[model samples]
Target: MERASRSNMQSILDYTDKDVRELHEQALENLREIGLVNPVDAFKALSAKDSKGRNTTLLEIREIYVSPNVGTEDRELSRIITLYPEITIEGGGQYSQLVLTFENNRFPDMNRIWQILESYGKESAEYRENIDDYPMLQLTILPLTLDGRYGFVMSSPIMWFLTPADPAEEQPRQIRMLIEPGGLQFVQDESYSVEKILEESRKMMASYKMDLQRQLDKEEAEKEMQREMEAEHKRFLESNVTNHTFGYDENTARTAENRRQAWNDMQKDGKFKVGNKRD
Candidate 1:
């Protein structure tokens, strides 16, 4: 008989809108105490506007904490804020706790945003909890409409547990955030039709095929060069051996002829007798 499994499973916490709002506010306050004088003033300086030529408000804020052990300069946080014009600080303290607020309806491409963030430094993934049999959140990078602008949404998956004791009792949920590029607004009227989307897909495939062909051509050229080099090396070795054997054979033939002539000379001088005779 199989032994009973022994495992300790923690209960999942349920996160609500109020909880999220509280956290956001607390994080803002924390940054404010650190050194952020006026977050609103800084945001206004960016002059962020939506499609309707209206000013945008704070849509979301992400808090990034630096390690205490790391000896970072005072300007590092300022540099990070400046690097992303779309982001600003709430308050000032150390580089350890920097609050970044994004403008409303401004969503950037996920890959592009990640690249920019990675350039600044390493970051950790954010997760929230829910209580259900399936995942509470599902994250995806897809096109979406936000505040009258079309952009990409970067989403994260939320897992919900049906039973706290069972490891397999869970479901998936998704939360998404819009990312918009600078100065570009996606109008609903400009949305691609099915035929246009298909055409764009075909063009992308063609471009991909061209790139693949170029790579294959480069590899083939390298292989052909290697083959030529090998063939040349083989020819060189064969030529060297042939020349050495020719010289050796010529020397041996000359030596044998000289020995024959010397024998004939000895016989003519009668120094070496051909037949055995009594003295």
Candidate 2:
């Protein structure tokens, strides 16, 4: 079970509105590529238009928690998400929550239910700022694993967002996977127990963090190297330069002055005066 935001809870708490909007656009583009209906339309159609507490804009999938009962007798696969959506009220107009499921069959392409919580509001710029605010919906998938069993959730290091789709379209588009690490295939290593899976995830996260740190360190070193080079170059120029402009020594300056004086004297010569005359 992968709790959304591996860094997300932090991001949700820290991201500015502009940050949120950028992420929202990315998710929508991804969904469009896969032929998924515009999340905005799907969400609006399924939700009560005038109803309070609707996710009108910006939706971030917090986590994709899949519990594989690897060693236990109960092979139940538990997949849950916090803020799971609500189904539309029948006859009254069924439009409520936006649930994305992946089906393993040709039934409807995918049949797996993903519980998405409503928090983002583009018009209002609203979101669940509190990471712990579990409003309790259809799918409140949390991290879980069994003893000795192991599994891991492959998620984006950079959080993703869903927003109304339309650089030009009037409607909002939903769902996009942005800035994934190497665009690696999404996976959750199987585990016999929730503990094992959680442990595995932790291990993988630690490894990823180390790699990120190394990259940051390398960039810093490169910058430091460049600064040293620039400083050395500047110092060399400063020490080599003479007091006179263009690095001319006092002797060179006197020589140039002498040459100028000679030319002026020649210009004043009586024999050359007539030829030098101009209208």
Candidate 3:
């Protein structure tokens, strides 16, 4: 008996192992069919380093012309160039706007400041409207930080005319900086950590298993309820049916007995015979 119990337990364990293996295989097939791969593996496959052990950097620039007036252009030009260390002046027509691009081996120190301006520009309606007149700068920078701890900043200068509430008042021009940061390696590092990804996957699998178990339990409960209902119906029929027949009720049995008795009385009265000769 002890050996038999041990064999049964081993069989159960084997069945569970088979089920787990099948589930994992099905999950892998689904991933392959959908062209989905582990994030870490995909990242590693595309990872590369340059000769300097850094990614290449690219800069995008745009010049927005808000109005024809050039009152503030000269005053703002000096300050804007001073703010950005890599700024280089270029000649432009009377109506043309100036834009500059710069690339360096080291990450720019003004990247943080540009990020702040970008955030502000996203929230400003004036800046958005000005962007419609001038295209936004879009660039991809390479040679990311060696330690994957740095980022890049790209921005464009915008000029708009600010008119006083009164029409007779002088119209003054205003200039605003629009900036955006890219290649945020530090944030990606935290989000793409192996431990974090594994934790998330485990949580997802646990939730799925819980949902499957709940569905199975619901189906089992429904089947048990149906069986109980069928049993109760059978007992009810047995109690109500006076005869051993399945469908006949007590009233039907009584009616059949009465009919038989009437036939017997008729035979005794000679109105009917059990076996009559037809001659």
| Per-model lDDT | 0.30, 0.31, 0.32
lDDT of 1 by residue, 121-232 (tens): 3222332233111111111111111111122212221111111122453421111222222211212323533233323334543554465467668777877877775665
The digit string of per-residue lDDT tens for model 2 on 1-279 reads 122223321212343445435434543453356353332333233332112232222122333322233453322222222112322211113222222221111111111121232221221133244332212111222212112111122233223344334465443233332333332221222333323333344454456456546766877787787777566544433442233224345454355454344334434553222221332
lDDT of 2: 0.31
Top-TM-score candidate index: 2
lDDT of 3 by residue, 112-198 (tens): 224434543563435543343322332212112112212223334343222232455443221123232321121223223222322
Which stretches of candidate 1 lie above 4 Å from their native place? 1-190, 241-279
How far residue 219's Cα lies from its native spot in candidate 3, in Å, is 1.7
The lDDT, on a scale of 0 to 1, for candidate 1 is: 0.30
List the lowest-lDDT window of 10 residues for candidate 1: 3-12
Ranking by TM-score: 2, 1, 3
In model 3, how large is the Cα lDDT of residue 201? 34
Q: How far is candidate 1 from the true structure (C-alpha RMSD, Å)?
A: 26.5
